[model samples]
Target chain A: MDFLIFQIPILMVQASMDGILLGILFALIAYGMALQWGVMNIINIAQGELVILGGYIAYFMYMAGIHPAFGVIVSPIVMYFVGWGLYKTIIFRVVDRDLFISILATFGISILTQQLMNFVFGSDVVVAQSNFGTTMLFNSMVTLPNSKIFAAVVSVIFAMLLVLYMRRSKLGRAIRATAQNARAAKILGVDTESVYAATFGINAALCGVAGALIAITFTLHPYVGLPYTVRSFMIVIIAGLGNLPAVALSGMGLGVFEEFSDYILGTEFRIAAVFLLLVLILVYRRFKLARKREYLK
Target chain B: MDLFKKIFSIFAAISFFVSLALPAQAKVEGDTIILGAAVSLTGKYSTNGEHTQNGYNMAVQRINDMGGVTVGGKSYKFDIIYYDDESDSGRAAQLAERLIKQDGVQYMLGPYSSGLTKAMAPVTEENQIPMVEANGASRSLFTKGYKYLFAVLSAANQYLEVAIDLAVEKNGGNPVNIAMAFEQDAFSQDVRIGVVEAAERTGSTIIIDDKLPKELNDMAATLAKVKATKPDVLVVSGHSKGALTAIRQISEMKVDIPMLAMTHCDASKLAKQHGKNSEYALCAAQWHKTLSYSDSFFGDGQQFDKDFNDMFGYAPPYQAAESAAALLVYKAAFERANSFDKEKVRDALAQTDMQTFYGNIKFNDTGQNIAKPMVLFQVRCEGDVCANRVVAPTKWASHELVHPIPSWSTR
Candidate 1:
């Protein structure tokens, strides 16, 4: 009934800043999906749960009189092992099987993790506060939380460090080789099976970092993992695997799009808008691919 | 095309699950009183569903202990036939029909939420069965003139009315600017309308009114908007999650507002997590342990709170209190009618007048309990200890009202 954005133009600035920062965190999670998809060739639907579990680890630290900001460092270490264990138990079995099997397997894992978190975390909406304070811009018309800015900066640093790690590290080279050709890498003594586990572990660690950031910047609940999973999957599909800049850009684009949609379409439709955009993007991509096929014909 | 196929199949599969209808097959023949309920036993509403069920179960146990309801010198033990609605309104409505038409259940108690009650009410009304509910508080439920629909709790719209009155009174007659973030669900939407009306009545301006995301997971965006606008008070009317998100984000973002009020503040469990920050956050409550309202069945309200805490290991929220009150209403109606006939009990319930451990039960023409006054409660933090204290309606005030809460910078 009322359009507050039109009345308050400053909210536009507020919304965009919030959206960009939030999107950076989202992109960080999506980057993990891209890494695993590129190297392991499997879509992990439990990405969101890994992020939430990562958040819980940080939340536990905060509860134990440790600063939540340190969760960015701690959560990944724990989640990496979790991811490795998962790979050893189930993900490894799904690898080289039909892509659909991986999706279904990961979906089952997602449900299992969600329920277990619900039991462990008690299903309450919890946040690990960083309390970094706020930096007001434009005479305080634009209010930016330092936690979000901290999260965004942290996300960027992680992304850059990850890129550097992949380019320079020995495990990274082996993973890249496996992504290119698992059979050839295996023939060349690259240990493709171990590389798959490492890739999944790295992806989960990335989710862990993003989840820790989310706990600081946003709120976390056990059941909220699906949206993160969907968002990351959508981001990976749009940006394509192995494209860092595009992933970042498209993740921010998706974030900015969500904020604007929340403004234009209201919050009730926000998730709907995200899922709808995913559909629209996939359809548009399909149409373009079909056109290329027609040209070849 | 492949993507389209996948997406289409997902939608189709979802619709298939949603549209699957259940067939009703039940019958009844006995002298025992059959109180049917389509309650939420699982899903999102399960927690409150458990509370609602406990209230009814306790009431039945209490009434039966007194040798149950007597009709024309015949004593009949009350037996409730409850079907788990799975927290789905459609399923709740179907179960309500099963209770009424198939099982021949003449009386009903409503479900956990306003939406579920709305769904089940039409079925009860169509069958002309008297359905008394404890939890559904939406204002729209009564305005429909459904004769058979009765609610024991205060209406939804009135929930924020008393809180606003206190806010204006506390602000010392100065104009207040409020920013609100509410969930889009029926109950929260009703709270938004009440808040807006109350804000208008107090000459307060709604600087920014936003709805929380459906998941109610994040409110950083909304609170950022609040930080920018710097409203005198920020009102969050989302259910428990929405309120929790607001408190968490407000503290995380360090947005300093003068006052913060939320509908589900009482349920946020901030005492365990962030009591220091949660201090002075005002919430509207239907029942408090401080309330001395007494009824014969559950003793005084304090005893009711204690017994419920012992039974469920958590303090009974107003939903549980009102639920037990609904049964008390049924007990009074049955005695007043002095007959087991459906029409007789319906007439008696329409003319029901009594008090319970929850509060006074006197239904207005629309079958709404207008006598129950919503009390405003606040979190009182003392060092590490935090407790909810009634802070409004001076008569109900266990402590003085905390006004113009200190900004984050000041705290």
Candidate 2:
């Protein structure tokens, strides 16, 4: 292991800052995924594609000579409708089905979406230039990109607003009731179908926000969506469904772990480490539950 | 009713096997010669795959429009059957076998990346099919001593060697400290080997050498190390995404190194996307429009660039240029062989020596084009528009090299 990170203490600060900010963005996508999984009981395999689709919206705006930060505002709005359409056409049919069925259906959508995006966007690795510059700390020894800071700030605001919306809004209450018991909510004269559609739409909109931030902070490729999907999936598993604060904390933890592993093990193992953590967490939870004569559902 | 059901099941099983045994068209149907290729149409390599397909299509069209290949006093047109390999090496090998055994393809075209090429090479070699590929540039591909495999592009090791030498020269002939990041893939790893060798030859010390993941999105950790070490040169190679990510992160971090060399600057359209931020970044290229290479069909490099842009709606990157040159090599080989026999055509390909709009195609004993030299270019910006200008080899130096890029504070 490379102990250089421990030797140079300032690099630790840099890696942590980068990890936490990046983790905030991951939490945003996981928030959406957790929402749909909890409310509709359908795991979306195309969650990353939604993020990338949202990023493409911002990239198009940038191509049209508009500031991409405006994408944070425009992308979610457009993606909401896109998500609503997707639910109406595809997801609605798979609702109330087996989890494996939904997974397979959404997996197909993921591949189809990747190809359509490749055809439309030319499969180029692209970025929207935010030009927000860098923020130097401790006499310029630790540098942080302002765009990443912007992304983290925006992500936190969105997460807070979402939490507030879910608590106070009428539609939000309907969604919570459906998540608690779909049949009971339906028996109580709640429109369960509308709640399902709305939940899926909101999840997609959240992905759009994350995607736009990534467009500014990192690179975008049609095929790169799978990594984000896996990361959000891992985060949601660690945090469990419907727990917003835990999602944020676990996302940051995962991000920090990634940066440290990258420094210690080298970048070639960065993705491997993330996946390895996923397997370890799964096994740990399995054993922890099995000790009480229980198992994961 | 049971007897009828059994009869129907038997008929269904027969039909399934019948479909499996359906015969494909022969290798040469009528006056057409069928070539097979498995390129990435939907995966990570799709962009370069599209370029390779476009190059192949452009050459096939131009060659047919001029006059099809005449073999044994009989004119024959070229047609290719393409399979989408999904950018997976295992799938590429399977498709190569399917192309030969199922589609009855006796001739083959190389896939997009070095990894896929390495996979398809063995299948073609085992089948004794003649294949000319454009994109696979890994040095190991040449070292394998495959008899029927030919390449039109320079080896991957030659890509950024001169950039390291140039760094030493700019440092007043003293050994320089170098930091390099390459993707963990066949092509990029070979490029890393080249840099390691170059470092040894020049007595330069590598301060930080990092292997980036294949699907890379960020390199902040590696860039942070470079900042801490303060190396003289920073080298990065990971195809288009690597180039774009490097410029984005380097600019954002403002990590200043005297020299930065990379690959795939043009393929990623870095000059256009990153604009001023991408300025002064040196890039290694297989071919450029400013080169003085020429052929009868596409004329000089400038003419081919214009024509390709007209056809594809974008400037042809070196990947596309080298791909188009592969077709020229094939056409010349076919004419020299004067027959459709695979053995004669293999010999003809081995003896290929000609000039095309991309470069001179002359394969050495190892099946690599040794006649062409890799060119280094710098992304130069005027006002807000940045363009790549040839800067090395002194023969086609369109602009003087910019050394020790202006620091971020000054910019």
Candidate 3:
């Protein structure tokens, strides 16, 4: 009742703008989650750490006197190899096991990567400075940073390029085939193992791009990766796997919802609201499906 | 075969007897007094936990180097037994109990954060052991009337009290309007209480008050409202992360608020991470290196800083300094009581009114340090470089306090 949103209409404009920009970044990370989930049939708990690792890569470059914006290109390339090596070493072993086993293994990787990043990055909250300036609108009432605008632009471009690569490329077709029927694709002489590895590597590359953007636009921390993981997971569940347009729309929706909840319920409840919204969506769908004698359980 | 089995049984019996004798001697013979801590060595508080451990380690080395604590007839070297609580409160409490009941550690130093310390408080109080903590500053922790919890650092309510006092003094005893955007955590909430009380005492008007967004991310709404109100001063009470977010947003928005003050802004850190945007931002600290306060064990403030930096390879922040001071309080209590008895140490700790390199240490009835004064520091930037200057109290002001900061375009 004491909320100030009612007093200031400009705050709605500001929050919406901030949330949309942030959501674009969220959607980018979620796209990666969706890719691996679709192709490899595995849930990567270490997805957030991968993002943070990518951010750190950009951060190290910034420290070395290179503009951090270049990380949007360079991080994905480095992370692709990192992801390929990860798949070849540990992920391959869990690929054929039970889903629970993969989940548990990725959870261990999450902890390991978090600690490793902490040691390498010195456990500090760091941000790569773009110094891109700000944009004022509505008679200077709502101000948006240029870094956010840049991040959104970069994310859209990456998403489009990825869509093109998936549709037109040969490896992309094989990856799609593997996603449709891994056992059948293997019988038809399509290297399913390489497809799975490529799928995970490309997924990690997408996360790297998103992470570099995040480091430029927002703050990065060693332990902060888990929240990004949760946000991407929520977005994937809401948008569904391989649904590109839905992913972007739902990502924006989540961002706006977070901003509104932050204004209405207070900042402390923002994460709680996201988790609660996920539960509500799942429960509502469960009931809707239950009417057809099909329960989620 | 029967002879071989008898020899094997005899050999096993002798080895088992020897092991039992060794442990019995280890338990009974006390060459050094052991203190225990449930520090967070591997989780969220790991960074600060490492600093706290280093503080404790440096203090122990110094005490032993100076021929340790002498109690009546014998001198025992100081040693600590540490357990990693992993930043979990349940684990902290469980480890605290194990330290006392199993490891035979009587003296205790508290953990890193208020939440972890709160979890361990009941264990210490129930066991009637004295725990002098450095970091747990939540005011509610003290109001519970726990006799065994003596804190070395100032309570959370005292965090920003000095900033208000300095602001009022600069305003020629007139009131200044303040906008508060505080993080809704126990520590920050406690800081708000202190800020509000100080503002009321100084007759400052609360033009705008808002809780900051989570993780201190995207506080543009609060900043916009502050800009609209145009309050003479803005007092923010968030942790370092919140302060950092505010700095970035404030810089981007170019909102020309006159003065900005915050809690937990270590100016050196701000200057390092955020360049010129950190300029003119005032922060209150419990201890600073230029205070000139000293004790018998630790030399002076400058000497303590040098010693700590030489040992830890970085300048000691207020947290590290407070951790070291906590051990100093223990040493004072141990020497005063002349025995390691829990009741005697607690009694001595209650009556402590001494001075250390950190500050004057005296506890009120609530076990909060009321005698010590918080120091104010400001980040001063020149073109591209930034440095923190101690700027208040006249006695400790290393530079003039820059009040009512210049407008964004002018800077």
On DockQ, the candidate that comes out on top is 2
User: Candidate 3, residues B1-411: lDDT per residue as tens digits?
Assistant: 999999999999998776555423332137687888999888767778888898888888888888887777678787888999988899999999888776766778999999899999999899888889998999998999999998888888888877777767778888988888888788888999998999889888887777764454567667776766688788887676777777888888878777788876772277777788888988878888888899887798889889888887888888888898888888878889987677988999999999988899999887888878777788998889987788876788899988779887788
After superposing candidate 1, which stretches have Cα over 4 Å from the reference? Answer: A1-16, A61-74, A85-105, A130-146, A186-193, A260-297, B1-34, B81-83, B97-106, B126-128, B143-145, B169-176, B199-204
After superposition, candidate 3 runs with Cα above 4 Å error: A283-297, B1-31, B165-177, B199-209, B212-216
- lDDT, candidate 1, A91-159, per-residue tens: 999899999999999999998997778655665577776768778788866767898899999999999
Write one digit per residue (lDDT tens) for candidate 2, span B341-395: 8999999999988999888889899899999999999999999989999999889
User: For each candidate, C-alpha RMSD in Å?
Assistant: 7.3, 3.4, 3.6
Least accurate 10 contiguous residues by lDDT in model 3 chain B: B20-29
Write the candidate numbers in order of decreasing DockQ. 2, 3, 1
Q: List the candidates' TM-scores in order.
A: 0.85, 0.93, 0.91
Ranking by lDDT: 2, 3, 1
- Candidate 1, residue A162: the lDDT equals 93
Tens digits of lDDT, candidate 2, A133-198: 899999998999999999999999999999999999999999999999999999998999989889
Candidate 1 TM-score, true structure as reference: 0.85
Chain A TM-score from candidate 2: 0.97
Better candidate number, 1 or 3, judged by DockQ = 3
lDDT of each: 0.83, 0.91, 0.84
Interface RMSD in angstroms for candidate 3: 2.6
Q: Model 2: clashing residue pairs?
A: none
